[model samples]
Target chain A: MEFNASLIGQAITFAILVWFTMKFVWPPLTRMMDERAARIADGLAAADRAKQDLANAEKASADRLREAKQQAAELIAQAEKRAAQIVDEAKDQAKVEGDRLVKGAQSEIEQQVQSAREVLRQQVADLAVAGAEKILKQEIDAARHADLLASIKAEL
Target chain B: MAAEQSATDYIVHHLTHAGLVPKTGAIFNFSNMHLDTFWVALALGFLFAGLFGYVARKATSGVPGRLQNFVELIVEMVDTQIKDAFHGKSRVIGPLALTIFVWVFLMNAMDFLPVDLLPAIAQAIGYYGFGHDPHHVYLRVVPTADVNQTFALSLSVLIIIIGFSIKAKGLLGWFKELLTAPFHAEGLGMQIVLGPVNLAFQIIELLAKPISLSLRLFGNMYAGELIFILIALLPWWINWVLGTPWAIFHILVVTLQAFVFMMLTIVYLSMAVEDH
Candidate 1:
């Protein structure tokens, strides 16, 4: 318990220990802690970036879906318009064909009627000549009867 | 019991140091080297350094082993304490505090071993190996309980304080502060008159720092050691009944004393570095 010189030895030892610890022990530990903190911060920042990327991708996909829907609608409208145009073209062709057929048939009928009229007129003229001849009970000159026949024909 | 043996002899025998006698008129006689104190203190210091050094060498950025975790916890604790108490930036103070705390705690913890254990072993070695008388063998295992040991630690802190003070304030400024601080007179004549008074007060204040610091730890540990020795004097069975509870209580004292020593050193150094 008495004061003695061993105090110096202890002091020197203490000083050496302090020096050793200051040089070796403390810096590494503090540095490690700082590094850990920095790493954690970096990780958090990366996570935030990933989250933002996910959101941006979601928005881009949504926009593409909306644009595709609009394009599909336009295509459907164009198809419908083309279908209507095809139907109208078919109707016009049918009408034109019907008009042509009707015209042709009318012309043929007119020709047939003409032919029948001609036959009828010929018969009528012959009948008139016969009647005149029977009444007179004599043969009339054929050249002189020509005017009567022509007149009969005109009247018919 | 031997015819010469008494309670006073027993206590004196326990208190004596085993060391070489200081040479007469030696300038370095102020440093009386105690073999027991040096050996115990150095051994414990090495233990602390080795453990911490191993941890430092194997330290990883990933999940740590149990030993690494424990070492890191201690490092963090001491770091936090230094941050809290020390106002100025110091590269040395953190490790210094750690060393002081751990070293002192280890020294003080030596008290928990049965009082006669090491001494008996030492006495046996001296008697059988060296052919020395067993009764002449002296060994005090608890280094911090020795005044010289505690004072050595405190005196080192005192040196740092002075060095820091001088560094913070120039030599002239530090001298002037020692002369005129904590008391000053308005007039030049009055100041001259009060110079010695202020210097005396300053010297006492400076000297008191180490004395109180060392004595506080030395006193507590010494008393604890004495109590253990007294308990040891009792019959073996009765010794357990008293020693167990005392040892448990002394555990707090051991840790607290170490904490006080480290805290005070930091505070003193902080004050030294600060202006005015």
Candidate 2:
């Protein structure tokens, strides 16, 4: 239990050890631990951000899908209306064409009937003149009877 | 070996240190070196610093290895203690506390070794290699068992505490506080009368820190070592009956003493830096 040189010796050794620890041991380990803590915090923050982004993206996609569905429904309704309009126009055009064709056929038939009547009238007139000539047996002057033939033609 | 000597001689032999003996008329001379205490303490100090230094060099911010994890556990424990007790910013306290805790712990752990193992080896070496008597080669492996070693550390802490106090409050301020504190007076006459008393109390308080710090650790380790030696003197078969339980209980003492020393040093430093 004597105080001796070992006291000084141990003190020197103790000082050296403390110095070594302060210089080389404490700082690096402490820094690494702090750095690790910061890194973990950053990682957690990033994960939270990713989660938020994912939720936002999902909402955006859902909104776009709803808009697309709405647009598709509007387009279908417009196409159906256009198809009905086309069918109505076709029916109207077909009715107008049929009316024009019927009018033309009626007019043509009237003109042909008038021409046939004229032909028949002219033939009857010629037959009557021939009968009169046979019955008379005497030669009549044709140039002088022009007015009478015209009257007879008109009566027939 | 024990059959020849009395129990007293065996216990005294175990307590004796292998070192340079003091010369005549010089009981407390520096020439008297406790070689065992110095060497063992030096070795343990290096072991503590070197291992920590190596681990600190290789330490990473990423996932740590097993050794790194274990080292970090201890370093963090000490760091937390410092942060909790020490509010002032000083770079020295952290490492100092760590060194004290780990070095003292390792030194105290020397109690776990069989009491006669190191001494027997030293005896064999001295007998075969140096032609000395086997019983004369005394070696105590536990450095903390030595008052000199414990005092050396505590004295160093005391010096650091004084340095901190002076740094915090200048020398004049510190002296002024020493004379004025723990007994503030209302007037000049009361102050004059109380100043010396306060100064006396302050000196005793200052002296008490190192004394208590050194003696606590030294007493625990020394007593534990003595008990182990006494247990070793018992019959070989019965050794485990007492040895195992004592060793188990000593584990607590060893770690607790180290923790107490470190805590006290930090507390003292913190107290030094604060005004009364």
Candidate 3:
């Protein structure tokens, strides 16, 4: 109730407490709080970046997969086309070989026919000459008969 | 009416301070000290400063524990109040407001203890431990109930306010504002005439801040403590009927007084910084 020296005491106490608080308490707490806020913001931004990277990687992998599928499809188509070309080439080769064989056999047959005709013509001429000599009843005029025989062979 | 004299004596005993007694004829003495108020307030101040210091030392930017959250809640609350009220920049104002609010609040909270608990214990120690007369041992636990304590805190605020005014505006500027403020004049002669008037008003205003600040907290806590003492004087069985309600109401009074003291301090400082 009375005004006393305790007032001064309390005032000194108050001042010292305030000084202690200013020096030790307020700055560190506020600094820590601000730092914590910044850290949280950084963490959130990092998370967002990670998510974006994941999406980008997913898109890149999808593109690579699509490209591989296209390449595989192109390779399969080329293989099929190559296989078809090989089959066509084999068929054409077989046909050409058969034609050659047929042609060769035909030529041989034609040659044989020509030789037989010559042999038949020679026999016919010999027979004809013999028959004429028999009819003329002599080996007279053999030189004149040779010229006739040559003309007959030419006609055959 | 049989218990009337004893009732008065009991109330006076509870109201008395455990400190140096003034000389017989002197009504106001500077040598007298309220040791109970001094020790209690000092201890509470240390408790506040110590705990907050501990928290600051271990404070992490990572996830906070419950205790850290609680401390942060209070610190942020005080910070918000300061930021709202104080426009000027000063490092002292924040810590000043925190100390006033927390220290005063702790002081006020001392009123919640049973009115005679500490006194009785002290009396027992004096009687048995020291072989002293128990009747002479007086202890008033709540420091804010003391006018000296509240006045001390508010006067400290007053000093700080003056310091802030001087810092915000230099000494010449502060003095000039004091002499020319709240009433402006066109000519130098007119201004000179109004200067003394303004100075008178300024002194009154300066004195009023501390007077009001100290008295408001002192009155509330003092009245509350008195009421508690009165309630203890009632029959033990029926004490709760009035005690419970008064205690509940006093809780609001205690917190509101502390908050008012802090807010007024910040407002006054802000006002000191601004021109008329």
CA RMSD of each candidate after superposition: 5.0, 3.3, 4.2
lDDT: worst 10-residue window of model 1 chain B: B22-31
Give the Cα RMSD of candidate 2.
Answer: 3.3
Q: Enumerate residue pairs that collide in model 2.
A: none
lDDT of 3 by residue, A1-156 (tens): 688899999999999999999999888988888899899999999999999999999999999999999999999999999999999999999999999999999999999898888888888877777777788867637686678778976886
Candidate 1: where is the Cα deviation over 4 Å? Answer: A52-156, B1-13, B21-32, B234-240
- Candidate 1, residues A1-156, lDDT tens digits: the string is 456678777888998888888877777877776676688889899999999999999999999999999999999999999999999999999999999999999988898888888888778767766777677655667687778767876786
State which candidate has the highest DockQ. Answer: 2
- Minimum summed lDDT over a 10-residue window in model 2 chain A is located at A135-144
For model 2, residues B1-276, the per-residue Cα lDDT tens digits are: 578889898898888888787334455777788888988888888888888889999999999999899999999999999989998999999999999999999999999999989888889999999999877888999999998899999999999999999999999999999989999999999999999999999999999999999999999999999999899899888889999999999999999999999999999999999999
Q: What would the TM-score be for candidate 2 when compared with the true structure?
A: 0.88
Ranking by TM-score: 2, 3, 1
Best by TM-score: 2
lDDT of 3 by residue, B1-276 (tens): 115448888888888898887334355679789999999998999899999999999999899988888888878888999899889888888888888888889999999999989998988998899987776788899999998899999998899889989998999999998999878888999999999999999999999999999999999999999999989988889999999999999899989999999999999999999877
* Models ranked on DockQ: 2, 3, 1
Per model, kept true contacts as a fraction are 0.67, 0.91, 0.82
How far off is each candidate at the interface, as Cα RMSD in Å? 3.6, 1.6, 1.3
TM-score of chain A of each: 0.62, 0.76, 0.69
Listed in order, each prediction's TM-score against the native is: 0.79, 0.88, 0.84
Q: Score the docking of each candidate (DockQ).
A: 0.34, 0.59, 0.56
